[model samples]
Target: MKEYHVTVRRSAPEGGEGYLQEYTVPFPDDEIVSVLNVLEYIYRELDPTLAFFDHAACRQAACGKCMVKVDGAVKLACKEPAHETMLLEPYSTRVVRDLLCES
Candidate 1:
């Protein structure tokens, strides 16, 4: 099966040190899947510890709650298409934990 290699910048709570963690998500080579979809799959099937602001988020790009840095460029996770290899990160240094940051 094809897959997408996603590297996420992770951190714990209370000013914890940050690190980079990579996850491989099963994906179709020609399919246009959103980055948020990969994250959901990881959270549901792989790691429950991964964090992001996806709760009650509007997936239509209308709501900017899923904003994050995709390969160094900030984009809406819900709207941005997934790539074969990508890096996911918070939009700013004020990350609460994982991909979530202070709004």
Candidate 2:
């Protein structure tokens, strides 16, 4: 299996300066990988403390809870295709933590 390099904007919900945290995730080239899947991999296999809006997310791109900035473009994580390298950030300035934001 190959890998995907991801840089995610992380922050404390309490309030403080946010910073980018990089992680390399396992990515199989034979299948389609979504941005949300990357986040799930990080949280499950890499870092459990990572905060993201996968809870109750539609995963079909119907519910927009999983919205984030993928390489500076606002997109639904469930629908956005993951590339080899990606920069993930909160879609809004009011970030809750990591790629999570106030909706």
Q: Per-residue lDDT for 6-87 in model 1, tens only?
A: 9999885566678899899997667679999999999999999999989554888987878999999999998899888999
Q: Against the hidden reference, what TM-scores do the models get?
A: 0.90, 0.91
| Best-performing candidate as measured by TM-score | 2
lDDT per residue for candidate 2 within 1-103, as digits (tens), equals 8799999889955778877899999976787999988999998898999988985536998887888999999999999999799999889988777777889
Error of 2 at 63 (Å): 0.7
Q: When superposed on Cα atoms, how far off is each prediction in RMSD?
A: 1.6, 1.6
Off by over 4 Å in 2: 12-14, 55-57
TM-score, model 1 to reference: 0.90
Candidate achieving the largest lDDT: 1
**Candidate-wise lDDT, in order:** 0.88, 0.87
Q: Considering only N, C-alpha and C atoms within 3 Å, which residue pairs clash in candidate 1?
A: none
